[model samples]
Target: MSKQDGSNRLVSGPEVDDSTATILHVDLDAFFASASLLARPDLIGRPVVIGHDSSRSVVTAATYEARKYGVHSAMPMSRALRLCPNAVILEPDFSLYSRLSKQVMAILDDTSPEVERLGIDEAFVGIGGLRRLSGGANRIGAELRARIRRETGLVASVGAASTKYVAKLASSRAKPDGLLVVPADAVIDFLHPQPVSALWGVGPKQQERLARYGLHTIADVAHTSQERLSAWFGEATGRHLAALAWGRDPRTVEEREHEKSFGHSHTFSRDITDRSEQEGELLRLATGVGRRLRDAGVQARTVTLTVRFHDFRTITRSRTLPEATDVTRVIVEAAWSMLEQLGEMPPVRLLGVRASAVQDASDHGLLWDDTETWGSAERAMDAVHDRFGAATVVPASMLRRERKRDDTGPSGGD
Candidate 1:
């Protein structure tokens, strides 16, 4: 490909042609809720909510039927139940969901080499080369949806467009399992009538602010003067929003590296105040993060601890490790140390552990080095955990910590 100019503008030359780029955005329909229904077929056609089983717990995913009752992911589970009294509440099954996500990702990989995963349920696949294999973008989208359904027993919505932003918006319009294509000439037609919220990063506050200025739709934003918009929303956001309104995204689909951060968090059934109990929860979170890192062939150089109090106040503390490692004991110890340093303990509504600043296994030193030795031990332990089950091996410290925490009482403070 020829390089663009200094302004990042496409350079015109004898070799340059006005060819269209094909991008396909794939979104799994009601991912967590759908996966839950797949595991238990009886839940099909019913309103389902997947989240924690606590009054203060937030919903992670909800079926379309539940969404009709105003239940949505991130909403409090109690409010969701109040909205849809008959909705089936289910706990988030991260392990099962992660496994199913791997299967779906593998299927995408089978279709194209340039696949950019947005999350567990969404991805963008560059199909410039797929025309030879699957006929064209439209055909490839159809085949992809059909394949996902046939193999995984799930439905996916797809949108084909020249730009990623338009492709993503098209997918949203084609929800509950459908595919729509917005050709280069039809991008404006497909996007103009949509609400401002449809644009990426336009959150509740931005939408409300824009609405007051009579900018209710993408078309309105597109038609607004840049100078006026900048005065209202500031220069950077104004230009960014305007570009999105015009469907001018220049992003290309490319494979992303393994995640740089891996973490897991839990919302308690009740607010926890005990330090020992908090440590037990930290150990659990550490184990989850460690398993993920090992599975991805990565080691973390830093560990972070996050705490959210009952009032929704959140704080995070991180520490750099002397050497990169993925051992559960080491990660948990690091997290516990940060937690202890926080000083003022409050009733914690949520606890999380994260491993960040990840590096490849090869980055570890010689075989005799401490990091290399730890890496090997972790690999062996992971093998045992995979073959038998997660509970096959437990860190000795975690076991002792849990026992001590449990004896202190449910809140751990007494």
Candidate 2:
């Protein structure tokens, strides 16, 4: 990789999104795999897998060549090996990955303070206020990529957009060390033709749900009635998805103060097909999530339920409550309600629970004693769990999976 690879030069390409973009989503090109290749340059363009060669070890990273053979991050190492039998399986070096991540982060820090890191590899950097001082967004993005190469021997791809959501899409479109600029007025033109699955919140299950309504494309979502979407995806999420379909994201790029959301999901060793069994798993997850929220001294306004079927199709639903609470009973009941929304259960692969829109737990005026009493009892249980172990205190109707996982686990917090 060099400064003169033409990635630093502006070219009229189809993948380019020429919106009045000031948000930069810069991601290192295969951070772990690329860093691994630095010492083994001979494997630069080869199928390299960065993970231990063990039965349960998962691929932490795989180079693009390995990806061509369908290997990817989080894939079981055994599967990756079977897919790319001749792949160079390298064990990960966390010390080296951390060092490079810090260097890359330092480079980002030099660019802007308003950088919201999504992971070690990618972040959303707001360059709107720095337009005058730093020759516009795309130029800054291109220069940043070049600077990373010159200083850290790394290549980066950047997506510049008016909002962080679109910016991320732009960056993915410009992969392997390239830049794509999605201008403001061009947002709709750039987004509408894309699949509805391209939207941030729409996953496999949601995709199938939307597909049932003939909403396959972003344009279809844009044209669909907000009321209809609300009826299907709940009021808040329905409107949110509609707005995204029209490229109407309004989120800002700011330094995070604390974690926004926390979640837990578990894949069953064997698929469970019974509805009652799935309910038991979801209830267990809700208890875990509620415990986490209370332990963090926070209350969550929204709860989400995720169900993955044997075929790998996932279904997720989110509900925002009128009031935020960290009570296990409330969370469990809400989660169960969401499961009921699925109509009937299919053979299940995984179940998960997540809480979001978190805020510090505070005593609002005129609060009831029951809420306070419940908090005290839960805190007592937390102490018991901490002293004895997570298995010491649990919901009376706990599943075997939950009870078995409690040993030596953290008292709470995801």
Candidate 2 structure, TM-score to reference: 0.60
lDDT of 1 at 101: 70
| Candidate 1 Cα outliers beyond 4 Å, as residue runs | 1-21, 366-414
TM-score of 1: 0.85
RMSD, one per candidate, in order: 8.7, 10.8
Task: Tell me the deviation in Å of residue 95 in model 2.
Answer: 2.2
Question: Compared with the true structure, what per-residue lDDT tens digits does model 2 show for residues 171-270?
Answer: 7667666788878888898789888977988877999998998899999999988999999889998999989998888899977523467566656656
Please list the C-alpha lDDT of all candidates, in the order they appear: 0.75, 0.73
Question: In candidate 1, how many Å is residue 191 off?
Answer: 0.8
Clashing pairs in 1: 274-411, 274-412, 274-413
Per-residue CA lDDT of model 1 for 1-414, tens digit only, reads 001011211111223121354898898878777877887898888888877656767777788778778787667778989999999987555655666677888899999999998766688999887776576666778889899999888888787788988877777776767777777876787679888988889988989999999999999999998888999999998889888988899888979756768888877777889888788788887877887777667888999888999999999999998888777778988998899889877799888888889988568653324655665677788778767766678766456542211100001000
Give Cα distance to truth, residue 391, candidate 1, Å. Answer: 5.8
Instruction: At residue 268, give the lDDT of candidate 2.
Output: 68
Where model 2 places Cα greater than 4 Å from the true spot, the runs are 1-19, 257-414
